[model samples]
Target: MACSIMVTAKQFFGDPITCITDEIPQKVMDTYCWIQSTFTLPHQLDRVAGEEVAHDGVGSYVDGQHEKKYHKYYQWVVFMLFFQAMCFYVPHYLWKIWESNRVRNLVSDLNNPILEDEKKTKQLKSLTMYLKDNFRFHKWYAARFFICEMLNFVNVVVQIWLVDRFLDYEFSNYGTEVLSFTEMDSEYRTDPMTRIFPKVTKCIFHKYGASGSIQTFDSLCILPLNIINEKIYIILWFWYMFLAVVTGFSIIYRCILCSSPQFRLQTLRMRNRIVDFHILESVFNHGDIGDWFLFLLLARNIDQLTYRQLIEQLDVSITKKTDRESFTISMDNERESKDEVGMLKIEKVDDFKKF
Candidate 1:
């Protein structure tokens, strides 16, 4: 933002040096030059040469300064860049909120060992149902994430249009000409004055109200500010292009990760290993692949685990009922053996007494 504002400031302060004139009277020239330097006007004049030139207000100079028009627009562009950055962050914030409110509580309940078996079983069933519902919410969150990237791409393209609109057709075509693969040569790249930003241009100045006649002057003027504008836009053009490519790739990668079942399964397996190995949470916490997406994938895996546990519990209950009579008979046989051993010991004692 400061860089952008600095470019505009250079243009504003340097507008006076944009035009130069010869052959005009020193008094008239000084007055005109003062006006140009002192005030921001709707139009400006270029250098002119003639034997006798009429004196008019400085407003009768060359074309209006393009930089004046561009300053406000550039500021707005910088502001929008900040706004888009914030937009990208909003989804992450919302995901954190959802995790705190919904996910943490479920995990705490499921991990508690002191709960009755029946209660734990019920909680598992409930957690599975809850996760299925949250999966739909994850889809929505993922959509928002992709939308942010799309907006970033759109912003870059819009900024390009804004550059063209304010800077004119010559600057608008700069990207195509400069970035063209075949057009770049050593001469074109090295010559900043002529190739990057042209400084020389024809300027017209009109002098009014001297002897009720208007005097016009035309000459070549050197625009120093064009150099600054040219350099700024060139860098911006490349920056926007880089931004567009990265955002495009991000969108594509995210789509592939979400849509492919195999990828989701692979992520789930990796997540399980992470949990089992007691890995650092930071490994998954601070990456482009967001924590919320990982959480959703893990939720699906937990749902599967819940179903498996329920099935095993049902199998235990059914088998226990069928084996009840066998278990009772084994217990009775052990008791009978103990009683017989005790009765033999008592008989030995009675025989000794009779002897």
Candidate 2:
């Protein structure tokens, strides 16, 4: 947000660019530079100013299409920064809304379990029952947070690509080119920052003359703001790339924990070894992915003593539920077997009667 405010002020409140000339009006030439943009003659950068080149990177660009680089990102940078800030905010907003004080409400007074004996017991039991009732239904809750991590990675990658296109593909290698500064000769060591954000560039303005003919005026423009731009973007380029790598690793870690039951069990055991091992195994076997995510979250928020008690209660309830289901299935199979035997007996009796 601060970045957005700063850029908006720089772009709208005043001009960061100034073009000097006597052939055309100052106001018209400044406006032309803002709209039409300025370009650098890269080959002219090597020539001395005032002798061969009028200004650094300010000379002929005709028939040198490959050598000329246009500065088109000046006006759009503010909007781009503003959009990036918005993209980051979206995940935060969604997490807050979806979470909606769940952890707070669940933890409630348990956060400080130093309550009176009866109050502690009551609060602990209430949390246990709530978890027991909703064991396999937290898939969305867990997925929402995981998705937030993924969105962070996606946003960084997309913003990088977008900025690359915004800066005429120069941004894709901006960091790499900056790193190779040591290899270049001292006599011709033009900073990659300068190439991307040049100090001086050329813009041409056209108008009608008194003789009913078009008049052309070439303006040499100075960008005092590119100094700040170069500094900001170089830092941002490295930071965003690092963030992408870290987030990608985070996603991989989550996948490993979720997909590998042994890994999840080990993590749980490390969190609270005092809990009965068989109870943990039973709870794990009876639940889905969402249930496992919620258990991990619970382990982090509550004390080990309270968590152990809660898991014990859940194990009791889930074990009974699973047993009832298994029993019902076995009875159903038995009933089906009896029906098949009865049909076979009936068929045999009919065949004997016909004989």
- Score each candidate by Cα lDDT: 0.50, 0.82
At residue 17, candidate 2 shows an lDDT of: 82
State which candidate has the highest TM-score: 2
TM-score versus the correct structure, for each prediction: 0.46, 0.84
Model 1 residue runs over 4 Å out of place are 10-17, 22-135, 170-196, 219-221, 267-273, 276-355
Clashes of 2: 0
Report the C-alpha lDDT of model 2 over 126-229, residue by residue, as the tens digit.
Answer: 88788778877888898899888788888888888988888888888899889987788866776788778987888878888999899988888988777777
Segments in model 2 whose C-alpha atoms lie over 4 Å from true places:
11-14, 48-55, 60-67, 113-117, 323-355
Writing each residue's lDDT as its tens digit, candidate 1 over 54-85 gives: 21112333444342211223224445445544
